[model samples]
Target: MNTLSYGLLSLLSFAPLSGYDLTQKIKPLWQAGHSQIYPLLASMEQQGYISYKLIEQTDKPDKKEYTITEAGLAQLRQWVEMPAEHPVLRDELHFKLYSLWLSEPQKAKELLYQRMEFCQSELDRYNEMLGGNETLREERGESHEPKATTFGRYMLIRKRIMDMESSLQFCKYALEELEI
Candidate 1:
């Protein structure tokens, strides 16, 4: 299945959420906007992957709360069991990198520096969220030590942050090498 379907199913698996919350979360994680999420949600509903109920909060207007259906859960199970596909890296930054030579070298250098800064900022944020002594379990007042499976997931996220930091360092070195 596509990322959108997998994302929707994953979010619903955690807890029922409104389309708006889903959209907001997707923006940061998947780089998707509402235009993409709303249509996909409609399509998933049509395909019987999910169902929604109108929820009226005491403090707010009625909202559609989405939950995964049986089919969706089954699909999620299959997805988890299946071998992961080789991830195809689609880097928008790379596109900009290649096109940079068309303009002044200084301009290209400036852009790359800006991108490195952005990556550094994101790495810092992820580190704050997932790294160090303070953790999700700690924040929730649960056991300081998490289950092995949860710890594994946490390590994976940490690895991703490290990978981003590595990429940022590479960009910094490349910029210096380019003398831009």
Candidate 2:
């Protein structure tokens, strides 16, 4: 299965989610759209990895809420045990920074400022997610001790929060460099 396929499965493992929900939830980690996701979901369903129930909404169109099958969970677990591929770096800001010498000082400063704002926005989002997780845990009467269901999410969000903070610091440093 492709990475996106596995990503869908991973999300389903947490809880059943509609196609729209899946598309929204996966955005922070993977770039996928309904065009790519629906087909994969269909293929996985055919392969007996996932199943969906169609729910009729009074206000909106009917939607399929997907859940991972046992086969899917087993595959997900196996995939987890396997070594992960190296992450691909595709940030356009890196290219902009590489060519910054050719750009105007004000333009460079604007780019860094935009990046700083983006980093702060992402930091706030991740912090909110972490808070939501904490609330969910407390509501369930679960202790802070790492549990199978949430440990990965908790750690991943924490790491992303750290990354965003570091990125903001780097932006500030670059802005200072541009000033000098």
What TM value does model 2 have? 0.92
- How much is the lDDT of residue 123 in candidate 2? 95
lDDT of each: 0.77, 0.90
- In model 2, where do residues sit more than 4 Å from their true spots? 136-146
Tell how far residue 44 is off in model 2, in angstroms. Answer: 0.5
| Candidate 1: tens digits of C-alpha lDDT, residues 50-140 | 9999998898889888999999889887887778778778988778876766878788778878888888888887777775645454543
- Candidates in order, TM-scores: namely 0.76, 0.92
* Superposed model 1: Cα runs more than 4 Å off: 57-61, 131-135, 138-156
Poorest stretch of ten by lDDT in candidate 2? 135-144
Using TM-score as the measure, the top candidate is: 2
